[model samples]
Target: MEMTTEILMSTMNTTGNGTIDGGNDVVTLLSQVSNILILVFLMISMGCTIELEDLKETFRHSAGFFVGMLCQFVLMPLIAFCLSLTFKLEGAGALSVLILACCPGGTLSNLFTYWTEGDVCLSVCMTSVSTAVAIGMMPLNLFIYSRVWTDDKAVIPYVNIATTLVSILIPVAFGVFLRWWKKEWTKYVTRFGVVLAFILIIVVWVLFFMLNPTWLFAGWQLWICAVLLPFLGYGFGYSLAILFRQPHFKCRAISFETGSQNVSLASTLIVVSFADSPLFLDMLFYPGLYAVFLYIDSFIVIMLMKGVMHLKKRRNSANDEDHDENKNDKIGLDNEGMATDQEDGVKVVAMKQIVADNSVKTDEEIKV
Candidate 1:
């Protein structure tokens, strides 16, 4: 719902004039264009992080890749749906949570994976695959699940989602070309993309909430879901990966992938589908809340992972030091044993010389 804010304003129009505002159309068009551009820029940056070798390696050990998809597409949506039921969320609340779950991993997941020193290649690849698959999977999930919560006959904005995904790939393909052809510039381009992506997110949110402060006033159940869902995702994702025996880096990447949803896309869908409906106001704000909580929770995971990695490093260093000390002690004991043997042999030789000299003296005296 790139144009959600404009839709929101128009929907909330209290003028009761029954006429559409001209200014809103301009705002909607601008927002839509800017959002698409931001996504393209971010996706391009994510694409640059992909390496030819990593792609080959991903195929070599494809278990982790499949696990990532399962966690993102299967487990996450299930978590969201279950949470909605458990919390007894009805109407727009249930729909909002479902939308978040159905969408693919966010572009920011790759960014967070990099920050956490995770498997960036796997993160990016999983995100790209999930997004491509979401063209079908997203609508399917909504179709199946939306019936559970309401009889509103939800509309899936498949065209908008498809257009967004296709546009995303165009920039990504270009970025990949840059990576392969102009390898020298890949580092700079990727860095620039990351920075720009962050700035865009901040700018978008600040502008959004600034204009609409009421979004921050959601119900406690929504807040609870927002906080609970991401944490559950991180925990389950990490545990599942460990059960599958994925390495630590891959686990972290998957955890972030599972937990950090593409909230921007979710918001876009809500805006596109429900903008003019009576339920628009109720559903529109939760995605922003989800974004806020996802970042906060994902950051906690990142810090915890970094701490564990540090402790592991320290323990390994301590073990190496202890091993070196034991080796040195063994070498010293061997040297001492060799030196004692040499000393004993020297004493035995001296005693033999003394005995020979004494016998020679006695024989000379007897002859005289």
Candidate 2:
């Protein structure tokens, strides 16, 4: 687990440098292929685990989901824009930030929401909806933003779009369908999917490291951005939830959803769209920093949530014990009172019988 985590961290950090080498191209390609396959398998597994009922539940919370989407689509991008202006980051840096903002929420949101005792169903639904929207929104947002900020024109590669559909959406739909048609298969796929995902993530990171050893120590600006952006995202999300009077759990979920951008997709887009340019090199920083911040911050948040949950459980257990003891004591006192009343009544009846017998015996003696 530790080794896998380290690899993921490395892959996330290797964003700007094209650290991948020609010698390791074959391995990287294989790893990317494997990653895609694993993702498909995981989606299938998710479909199996998700009942129609789960979807219904998710839909019921559509209002909350829409609110979250608004945060991602409207609020976050605006913030990114404002940040770009404040930082005076034009050209590649500005475009990169915009690209990060435009991309939808990713798979990690579900994990983080679950970790924080947030609504997993809502997170999943949001991911699906955001991904679907990204098909159109990603291109539009990038094109407009790039045009405004840089000389570079944004183009969404059709091949990459198709690949995304095949790898992500098709598999998810298939998984959902399989879950309804062949329930048992879904379970098997989900289990296998997890192992596959871990392996692919590891391979990608390893190849990244092998390709760019120096980048491992470089990209301080990227790292800083990564750390700060998520923190800002969470803060904004939580504040919005609080202002709206949303529940604590939902608040946590929204915070995570807002903060965790789709770094993987962003990285892929940068590679495919800007492979030749030095701008592509700069663009790498956004996803690299985003990934690094996400893993570290998420770990801390999850651990804190776990600790809080443990304390809550202990308190609840203690309260239950106290309630039970109080109920038992009340029952014992009631029984004792009933027993004393019965004993007094018995004594009174015995005394009455004795008086009657003595009076009858005295009458008989007088008659004799």
Candidate 3:
């Protein structure tokens, strides 16, 4: 479970205060290495579950997907930038927020969408596409934002995009290929992938909490921002869907896709880019807040959708029962009419026979 900022910060302060000195270069290096390994594993697991059919379906709804992506990649970053200016967040906090906004939707969005009766295919599509784009866009966005916000020139660390291609893209392609080749294996892989991703997320979050305790206590504002940002993303995405005259389900799906940031990728980027900066530790808070927010929001949305679906099913069941009762009544009336007709037919036959016998007896008497 992703710990709420309050709990994490408090726990960090109380427990992990002197365990590992933050000033130690070796510890920071270890943290970065741990984050990278976990990220690679998580990405690979996530990739294995992605089906080509799902991606194809996502593209089939290209207009909506594109629009939602634009909002996530473009509009969201702009909004975060504006918020940074308004709030005057400097150093790690400002960069963290900007990076968080720039990050694409998480792979977990598919699960949430499925839970909420949204389009899972679309969510998966958006996540994969956005993540691929993020390989380039993440560094570029950070550089651009840093230049505008800070007087000191910041260097965005060089990431091996090719390594991402190998680790993330290749694995995902292989997963999709496997789906095409052996569907049964794909099912098992998807199940395993889900479990693996969850475990990795838990481990990363725990390590982060262990490293930074202060972010847990006075981090109420970060928590608030995290919780609110996702809701805003969802609301804006939903509204856009409505504007596009999309169906209710598609609207909901797009909302989820827009709301859920790929925090795993964001965390990895932070570990890679800002491993040395004390100010950059705020990057840890960005994904930590997101992980917490996404968990809560996904649960709430899923429950609400389930409630609505349950009510709809109940109403439908009642209507079906009424329809069945009406059918039974009609069948009963028809059976009663059939029974009456059979009795009337029998009586008519007996009466005709009696009249014939009487006529024959009268003719015999006249002959006698």
- For residue 211, what is the lDDT in candidate 2? 45
Residue 319's lDDT within candidate 1 is 100
Q: How many backbone clashes does candidate 1 have?
A: 2
Ranking, lDDT, top scorer first: 1, 2, 3
Candidate 3 — which residues are off by over 4 angstroms?
1-55, 78-95, 114-118, 133-166, 217-220, 242-249, 264-287, 341-368
Tens-place lDDT per residue, model 2, 1-368, is 11112233334344457464445556555655665665666556555566778789778766677678777877777777767766667466777777777777766666567557676567667777777777887877776656766666566545544554455556666777888898878767776876676576666666655544443453454455566667777778778877877777777778778877876566666666676777765665566546655778877877876798789999999999999999999999999999999999999999999999999999999999
Q: Which ten residues in a row have the lowest lDDT in candidate 2?
A: 1-10
The regions of model 2 sitting more than 4 angstroms off are 1-21, 82-91, 114-118, 139-153, 156-166, 173-192, 212-219, 238-253, 268-278, 354-368
* Residue 138 in model 2: lDDT: 80
TM-score-based ranking: 1, 2, 3
Better of 1 and 2 by TM-score: 1
Instruction: Output the number of the lDDT-best candidate.
Output: 1
Q: What's the lDDT of the predicted structure labeled candidate 1?
A: 0.77
Listed per model in order, the count of residue pairs whose N, CA or C atoms clash below 3 Å is 2, 1, 1
TM-score per prediction, in order, is 0.82, 0.78, 0.69
Report the alpha-carbon TM-score of model 3 versus the true structure.
0.69
